[model samples]
Target: MYVLIVGAGQVGKMIASNLEDSHDVAVVDRDSETAEDLTYEYDVLSVEGDGTELETLREAGLEKADLVVASTDSDETNIVVCGTAKTASDAFTIARVRRRTLLNTWEGTQGAFGVDFMVCTDLLVAQTIFRISGFPRAQDVETFAGGLVRMAEFEIGPQSPLVGERVEDVDEYDSMTFAGVFRGDEMIVARGDTVFCADDRIVVIGSPTSVKEFAMANVPETTSSAEDVVVVGGSEIGYQAAREFEAHGFEPRLIERDHDRARELAEALPKTFVMESDATDTEFLDREHIDEADIVIAALESDEKNLLVSLLARRVGVDRTVAIIENTEYTDLFETVGVDVAINPREETAEEIVRFTRTNQTEKIAMLEHDRAEVIEVELGPDSALTGRRIADSAADLPDCVVIGAISRRGDLVTPRGTTVLEAGDHVVLFVDAAVLDEVSTVL
Candidate 1:
C-alpha cells in the first residue's frame, strides 16, 4: 500500500512512522526543515510544499497514492488538502480536525468535504477522558466489540491488594483475560504464573462488567465509578468532557476563568455547574470544595496549564486527576509528576486514522503505552489460519507476544480460553506486541 500523509506534525509523523515499516509512505510539509527531518527520521519520501495546492499534491505522488491523510494543524487546510487529493486521486482521504462541529457537519453529509473519514481531536480526547473517568484507577480504557468487550490498563499501586498475587490467584473474574503487562520498558505476556508487581501496568480485556469487577477487587475505593467530576477548563475539550459526563447522568462541575465562556457553557450544558474562576486559584478551589471531588479533569489548551491544574487538584486532595496533554512527549512526565492519567489528543487522533489504513478486516484498534503494544479487533474470514482451529492450537503457531483477549460471535461476548474454538465471522480481539503487530495482523 502507498500512503501519503500531508503534514509533518506529531500526528502525521506518528502515522508515517507506523506505516513506513509495512507500506510505502510519503509525507508533505510546507516547512523545508520538517520535510528534511521526516526524510531522515523514517523510511519515507518527503515533499516540501503546501499540501493544499494541487501542484504540491502531484509532487508528493498523490496520483498513485492508495490513501491520503490530511493532518495539518489547520482544520481548513486539512479539509482543502483532502478535497484537492480527492479531485486528482482515487485514494481514500482522511481529515484530522480539532473541531467537533466540522465532524458533525461531515457526518450529517457523508463525504461532504471529500474526506472518506474525519477524526476530531478534541472530541476524541474528551471521549477518552470520559472513558477513563469510569474506571477511576485505570491508566487507559477502551471499549471494543460494540461496547461489549472492554480493554483497560491499570497501574498497580504499591498499596494495591493484588501487589503480590499471581495472575492465577487473581483470576477470579470469569470473563476477564490478563492480556499483558508493561514493566518499565519491557513487555511481558501475561501467564498464569505471572505475579502482579507494583508499578506494573497490566492490560486486561473482557466483558465490561467483568473488567469493572476486577478493578473493584484490587482498588475498591479508588476503582468505583467516579461521580463527583470537576473539569478545569472551558476549552472545547473540557466543555465536551463536561457534556459527556452530563449526558451519562453525572452533574459535573466545570471551572472556567472567562465569565462569558462560563456563561456560555452554563447555557450549553444545563446540567453542568459552570463556575467563573481560575482553576489554579487555591482559594476558589477550596471554597468550591474541589478537594472532595471524585475526579478532577484538566483540559486546558496549554500543556503547562493542564499540568499545573492537575498538580493543584492533587494537592487539594482530589481522588484522581485526568489531564489533556497536547504534547506527546509530556505524557510520561505528566503521569510521573503525579497526574493519574494523561490524555494525548494527537496520539488518539493518529490511532483512529491509522485503523483505516489496514488492508485486512480489522474492526477496531486501541494503541497502548505509546504504541509499544496494541489491542485490535478483527473479524475472521474463511481463509484465516485460526478460523477452524482451537485458540490453543492456533496460538502455538503464532508468536508468544500475541494473546487472544476476547471474541464476539453473532453479538455475544465470548471469553477466550485455550480450549475455545475459533470460527469464521467471529470478531477476535487480541493484544499484540507492536513488534509483531504486522506479522500477527497478516495471519489473523
Candidate 2:
C-alpha cells in the first residue's frame, strides 16, 4: 500500500510513522523543517508544498498514491486537498477537520466535497473522554460488537482490592477475560497464576456488565455514580462533554472564564449550570464550591492552562481530575503532577486513522499499554480460518502471544472457553502482542 499524507503536524507525522513500517508513505507539508524532520525520523518520503494546490499535489505524485490523508490544520485547506486528490487519483481520501459544521455537511452530502471519510478531532476526543468518565480507573476504554464487548485498561492503584490477588483467585466474572498485563517494558499474557502488582497496567475484555462488576469489586470509590461534576472552559471539548453528561442524566456544573461563551453554552446545554468565572483563580473556585465536585474536567485550549486548573482542582481537594492535553509530550508529567488522566486529542486522532488503514476484516482496534499490545475485533466469514472451529484446537496452533478474549454473536456476548466454537458472522475480539499483529492478521 502507498499512502500520501498532507500536513506534517503531530497527527500526520504519527500516521506516517505507523504506516511507513509496513507500507510506502509520503508526507507533504508547507513547513520545510517539519517535513524534513519526518523524512529522517520515519524514513518516509517528504514533499514540501501546499497540498491544497493541484500542481503541488501533482508534484508529490498523487496519481499513484493509494490513499491520501488531508490533515492540515485548516479545514478548508484539508477539504480542498481531498477534493483535488480525488479529482487527480482513484485513491481513498480522508480529511481531518476540527469543525463540527463541516463534518455534518460533508457526511450528510456523501462525499460532496470528495472526502471518503472525515474525522473531527474535538468531537472524537470528547466522545472518548465521555465513554471513560468514572469508568473506574480505566485510562482508555473501547467498546466493540454493539457494546457487548468492552476493552478497558488501567494503572493498578495501591488501594485496589485485587492488588495482591492472583488472576485465578480474582473470582473471574463469567463474561470477562484478563487480556494482557504490563509491568514496565514487559508484556505478559495474563494467566491463572499471574499476579497483579501496584502500578502494573492491566487490560481486560468482557461484557459491559461484567467489566463494571470487576471495577466495582476492585476500585469501588472511583467508579461511584451520582457525584457532582465540574467542567472548566467553554471550548468545543468542554461543551461536548457537558452535552454528553446531560444525555447521561447528569446536570454537571460548568465554569467558563469568558462571559460571552458562558452565556452561549448555557443556552446550548439546558441541563448544565454554566457559570462565568475565572477558572484559574483559586478564589473563584472556592467561592463557587467547585472543589466539592467529584470530578473536575479541564478542557481549556492551552495545555498550560488545563494543567494549572487541574492542579488547582486537586489542591482544593477534588479527588479525581481529567484534563484535555493538546501537547502529547506533557502526558506523563501531567499524571505525575496529580492529574488523573491527560487526554491527548492528536494521539487519539492518529490511532483512529491508523486503525482505518487496516486492509483486513478488522472492524475496530484499541492500543493497550502504550501500543505494546493491541485488541482487534474482526468478523468471521464462512471462508475465514477460524469459522466453525473449536477454539481449543485453533488457539493451540495460533501465535504464542495471541488470545481470544470474547465472541459476539447476534448481539450476545460470549467469553470463549477452550470448547467454544467460532461460527460465521461472529465478531471475535482478540488480544495480540504488537510484535505479532502481522502474523495474527495473516492467519485470520
Candidate 3:
C-alpha cells in the first residue's frame, strides 16, 4: 500500500513512522528540514511543499497512492488537502482536524471535503479519558468486541500481593489472559515461567469483570465511586470533556477563571456547573470542597499550568487526576510525578490514522506497549489463512509473541483454548508484538 501523508509535524511523522516499514509512505511538508529528516531516517519519500497545492500532491505521488492522510496542524488546511487529493486520486481519504465544527460541515454531503473519515483530536482524547476514568487504576484501557471484552494496561505496585508469584502458579480464570509484560524497556510475552515483579508494566486481556478483578489484585487504589468530577480550565478540551461526561450521564463541575467566558459556558452547558473562580486559588477550591471530589481534570492551555493544578488537586485529596499534555516530553513526568493519566492529542490522532492506512480489512486496531505491539480485531474471511486451521496448529506456525485474546462467533464470546477451531466469519481479537506484524497480517 502506498500512503501519502500531508504535513510532517509530530502527528504526521508518527503515522509515517508506523507505516514506512510495511507500506510505501511519502510525506509532504513546507519545511525542507522536516521533510528531509523523515526521508533520511525512515523508508519514506518526502516532498518539501504545501500539501494544499495541486503540484505538491503530484510531487508526493498522490495519484498512485492507496491512501491519503491530511494531518496538518490547521484544520482548514487539512480539509483542503484531502479535498484536493480526492480530485486527483482514488485513494481512501482521512483527515485529522482539531475542531468538530469543521467535521460536521461536510456531513451528508457526498465528496464535499473528500474526507471519508474524520478523526477529531479533542473528541478522541475526551473519549479516551472517559474510558480510563471508569478503571481509574489502569494506565490505558481499550475495548473490543462491542465493549464485552477489554484490554487494559497496569503497572504492578511495589506492595502488590502478586509481586512474587509465577504466572503458572496464579489461579487462572476461563475469562482472562495475561497478554504481555513490560519489564523496563523489554517486552515479555507472558508464559508459564514468567514471574510477576514490582514496577513491571503489564497488559491484560479479558472481559470487563475479569480485568477489574485483575486490576484490583495487582494495584493499590482508593475505594471511591468517583461520581463527583471537577474539571479545571475553560479551554476547548475542557468544554469537549464536559460535553462527553454529560453524554455519558455524568454531571461534572467545570471551573473557569474568566467571568464572561464562564457565564457563556454556564448558559451553553446546562448539565455542567460552570463556576467563575480561579482554579489556582487554593481558597476557592477549599471553599468549594473540591478536595472531596471523586476525579479531577486539569485541562489548562499550558502544560505547566495543567501540571501545577493537577499537583495541587492531588495535594488537596483528589484520588485520580488527568492532565491535558501537549508536549510529548511532559508525558513521563506527569506519570512519575503522580498524575494518573496524561492525554496527548497528537499521539491519539496519529494512532488512528496509522491504523486506518495500514489496512482496510481489519475491524479495529489498537497500539499497546507504546506502539511496540498492536491488538487487531478482524473477522475471518473465507480466504483467511487461519480460517480452517485449529488454534494450536495456527499458533505453531505463527510468532511466539502472538496471543489470541478472544473469539466471537454467533454473538458469543469464546476465550480461545488450544482446541478452538476458527471458522469463516468469526470475529477474533489477537495481540501481535511489533516483531511479526507482517506475519500476522498475512495470517489474517
What C-alpha lDDT values do all the predictions have?
A: 0.91, 0.85, 0.85
Q: Tell me the alpha-carbon RMSD of every candidate.
A: 1.1, 1.7, 1.6
Instruction: Choose 2 or 3, whichever is better by TM-score.
Output: 3
Q: At residue 218, what lDDT does model 2 achieve?
A: 80
The prediction achieving the highest TM-score against the true structure is 1
Tens-place lDDT digits, model 3, residues 1-444: 889999888898889878888999999999988877887888899889999998999998987988999989998898899889888888989999888787677675766688888889988988887888777677788888888788888887888777989877874767888888888788888887899899888888888887887776668873424588888988888888888888989899999999888988898788999999989889988999999887898988999999999999998888889999999888889989999888888998998777776455687778875588888888888898888889988887778999898887877888888799989988888888987988788878
lDDT tens digits, residue span 270-331, model 1: 99988999988899999999999999998888999999999999998999999888878898
Decoy 2 TM-score against native: 0.96
lDDT at 267, model 2? 96
Clashing pairs in 3: none
Highest lDDT model number: 1
Clash count, candidate 1: 0
TM-score of each: 0.98, 0.96, 0.96
Tens-place lDDT digits, model 2, residues 46-99: 899999888888877788888899987888998999999987799989999998
Q: Please give the ranking of all candidate structures by TM-score, highest first, separated by commas.
A: 1, 3, 2
